[model samples]
Target: MTTALVTGPTSGLGRQFAIQLAAAGHDLILVSRDETRLTELSMELSESYGTDSEIIPTDLSDRDQLAVVEARLADP
Candidate 1:
């Protein structure tokens, strides 16, 4: 199973990308400042497509948070 990392996954293209990827049977690493929305989307994807997601509550504008995301990407 492939895993995809998506930033700003709570809305717009990122959200659509996550959905499409989930439909195609990819596990997800979803990143966003909005943890609630991320959790909602994760649950929705899981229920809809049996998708599994790891949500990261991150604001990429913060360097420290961005570093966390970078590390996850490197190792995930």
Candidate 2:
């Protein structure tokens, strides 16, 4: 299965992207600033679409957290 790592997925375009990507049969790695929203969305997407969804609550504006995210993506 293909995986998509989507940043800022707790609201707006990012939220929609997560939903759509889940619907499209992609496993999702959802990143957002809101932990509650991220958990909620992860549950909703997993239940509704029968797809795996992982949440990483992160503030991308922070350089350290952004580096972590980049490292995760770059992992083999």
Candidate 3:
């Protein structure tokens, strides 16, 4: 199964990307500072597209947290 990690995916263009990618059958790893919005988006994607998604609420500017996302991208 293919996966795409998307940053700032709680709204606007980022949210659109998440939706489109879910439609395209990519399991999503979503990053956003807003946990509530991220969870909402994940549920919507699952209901709308039947695609599974994981949410990581984080500020990507932090080096340690950025590394966590980087690891997921690199290993996934």
Candidate 4:
């Protein structure tokens, strides 16, 4: 089971990437500042492709928040 981490998944290319990855049977770790959009994308992927996603509402420009994402990736 491959998992993809996608940033800025609320619109444009990032949203398309999430959908394409889900179609390819990849689970997701979606990162964005907008929790509402992230949750919406998560549910859409789950319903459309049986994809499971963990959404992290994060502003990556902030050092602390970037560290959080870095930690998850490092440990995973």
The candidate 3 region of ten consecutive residues with least summed lDDT is 67-76
Off by over 4 Å in 3: none
Flag the better candidate by lDDT, 3 or 4: 4
List candidate 1 segments past 4 Å from native.
Answer: none
The number of the candidate with the highest lDDT is 4
**Count of clashes, each model:** 0, 0, 0, 0
Order by lDDT, highest first: 4, 1, 3, 2
Candidate 4 per-residue C-alpha lDDT over 5-67 given as tens digits, one digit per residue, 9 for 90 to 100: 999999999999999999999999999999999999999999999999999999999999999
**What is every candidate's alpha-carbon RMSD to the true fold?**
0.8, 1.0, 1.2, 0.6
**What is model 1's C-alpha RMSD?**
0.8
**TM-score ranking, high to low:** 4, 1, 2, 3
Query: Model 1: per-residue lDDT, tens digit, 1-76?
Result: 9998888999999999999999999999999999999999999999999989999999999999899988978884
C-alpha lDDT (0 to 100) for residue 26 of candidate 2: 94
Candidate 3 global lDDT: 0.91
Q: Which scores greater on TM-score, model 2 or model 3?
A: 2
The prediction achieving the highest TM-score against the true structure is: 4
